[model samples]
Target: MKMKKKSATLLTTGMALTLALAGCGNGSNNNNAASSAPASGSASAPASSQAASTGNGGSAVEITFWNMFGGGEGDFVDQIIKGFNDSQKEVVVKQLRLESNEYYAKLGTALSSGKGPDVAVAHVDRISPFVKAKQIVPVDDLASKVGLDLSQITASNLQSVTYDGKPYAVPLDTHFHMFYYNKDLLKKADLLNEDGTPKLGEMTPEGFEKTLAQIQSKVPDIQALAVNTPYFQEPFLNLYYEAGGDILNADMTKAAINNDKALSVLKFYMDVYKNKYADLNDKNPWDSFSNGKAAFWFGGVWEAGVLLGDASKNIGAMPLPPIFGSQTHWASSHLLVVPSYVSAEKQEASAKFMKYFSEVGGSTWGKAGHVPANANVTASDEYKSLPYRDQFIEAQKTVKFAPQTDKYTTIVTTIAESLQNIIFGSESPEDGLKDMEKQINEVLDN
Candidate 1:
């Protein structure tokens, strides 16, 4: 039910891997305006008021922002909301920190009560449910107002937030996957070229196996791979894609667990983590990698964000090694939104503040280890020049996203569990998946 970081150094080091930031804008709170329309029917529409002002007959537009981020990510968010507060503020964004587990339950309760954050941070995966519930507004209005083109965001990442033909939320950034191998070990094992990085293009699942075999033969105590949850399961989809298995038919109503391609992926994992081709019995694979034991791992740009602390002195990165014909990174993004409950006055003020957040705050977020979707901000001299951006951007070009469906929570929860069984020896890959198909398809049937 919970995802855990690996136990080894490379894995444990990833314990800090998070995709959050201090947030958007100048992070300053100043001028306050009255609500766009008073809810009580007698409030005046001041030229300058709080960003929370809404035109509910002149009531303050109070929006609660529910988020799973609470790191430098929180600080980043604070800055942006503060700016919205400072701008000719009619809309007020009040942010509430929710543990990853508590986020949805709280959101559900709020929505049912008509008291939810006007603009809560909803994931692409969570979009369908909110759409079905009518809790959020289609962002097209705001995007048009600001001259922001949704096409500017990565299509794959954007796909997640789109529902029933309309885009519900804004695309944030690609928190995509990567495969990190120990440069030092690969070199010692003669797996690297003269440049010290492995010949990644040639790093197939078979090749990945051979390289790990080499490491295992030479270093008996060290595991050659790590199987961090959720992240560990991510590669399977790409591998399945490579193996030629379509997760669902166009209808999104059926499971293709029976596909031979997906099965091969499971078998591959069995060899690496369960069948014993390499030693992978660790609590955290990334830790094994960072500690210099595990040779290859599947992680993401967000994973590297955690390493932002002592990056220069600590580690290295690479695109995910080839398991399929071409490289496909797994990723996600974050966005800033204006909810429908806010009045037109607050919407205008919130939009202005959001613009500032998108501009200045975007780059600040990049500093906290996230790639910003704000083009002007992301392309600035500082962002493009940062060492982290230079290395991580390579993966953004080919990243793929998990299908964002209202049922994603149920889907991921079941799949992650079944995948654990396949990797940890509780069941055979094929056997586990056949059973998994039944369970997943049931959700779709509902």
Candidate 2:
């Protein structure tokens, strides 16, 4: 029953967010490396010939890595792995690119069967169940041996991966929700300040509404906000957090979402779609923003690399505005963990790879638009100078992660459906909130 619960919760998040990308490196075979299954020896490693000739006189320990990263993020992971492979002679990390939905379930199953990858990627919030299931091993000793600087990592990020005072995973990056604006569109709408930043008069609900209205009135052809279905639930949650709402009560015994603040936030979200400031049915909201048809986009810092790399676009980024008198932001972190079933040698090798990618290769990952969990890296001149990163770096302080519970995926899934229903006009915010509260409470009670 516990395993079943783990599989259900983990798989839901994996599948919903997995991305596949082109231009992956590190000798990863495009044909064999991509799989929706867990990384067993027979399933997701490279052939012997793919080993790094430069590493350990061609006798490197090749370890399997299972992760859900694709597109630009995928490319960055592959590059980091390739760099580690090239720089070392002791470890050759072979990556298995798994689709998100298939990843967690397969990983849980394989770990139970003692056939999981040597190293795996787990989101900070999602790591708890794996820890409880005893499927992932703590990396403290291995991390120490590899000279991992835990002290240099951000306090909140380090805390996220720590379970029972033991470090179960190495945090790679902090991906938080932030605001992305089209420079030209905001300027045309007269929403720009003297410094060229969006001059949304205040952070109040009315202020935000007026700003959206101004942009919509001036642009006419573009959306004031660009967002897809998968991302629709975030702003609601962020606003709820800003309004001083908590997902769970003090004891984590039940859902605490059916409140006035939540209702107010939900109503505001629905109005965005109703007023035509955004399209509820828009298939590719990022496309609208990317093509200069949207003035404001609320998305992860991961969008930084793509927008900055595009020479045709002028993008400005900022933390999500304080719409409810607080600047709370939604956030999550990518953590590198070692599965418990691996041998000591493999564990050490995996730890070395994790350290390299997260510490030595931290700068490169930062360039991809995520805030590195490594505090020293973030403070470095290189990271500080990256395209719009400095503008939103301050948001790390107020970033609010989802509640840490085994039922997180279930709760998030419930809220997402309810949000979509409200946006689609199939359910009213009041009804949606009631349903969300009931469903979430049921999950918690179970």
Per-candidate TM-score against the hidden true structure: 0.78, 0.87
Q: Candidate 2 on 254-333: residue-level lDDT in tens?
A: 88988899988877877788898988778888888888989988877888777766757987888888888888767999
* Alpha-carbon runs more than 4 Å astray in model 1: 1-63, 83-92, 146-151, 229-231, 242-244, 274-280, 308-314, 337-342
Give me the overall lDDT of model 2.
0.82
Model 1 lDDT tens row, 42-130: 22223222333443334545544557778677787787677665553345556566666666666665555454444556555566676
Q: Using TM-score, give the best candidate's number.
A: 2
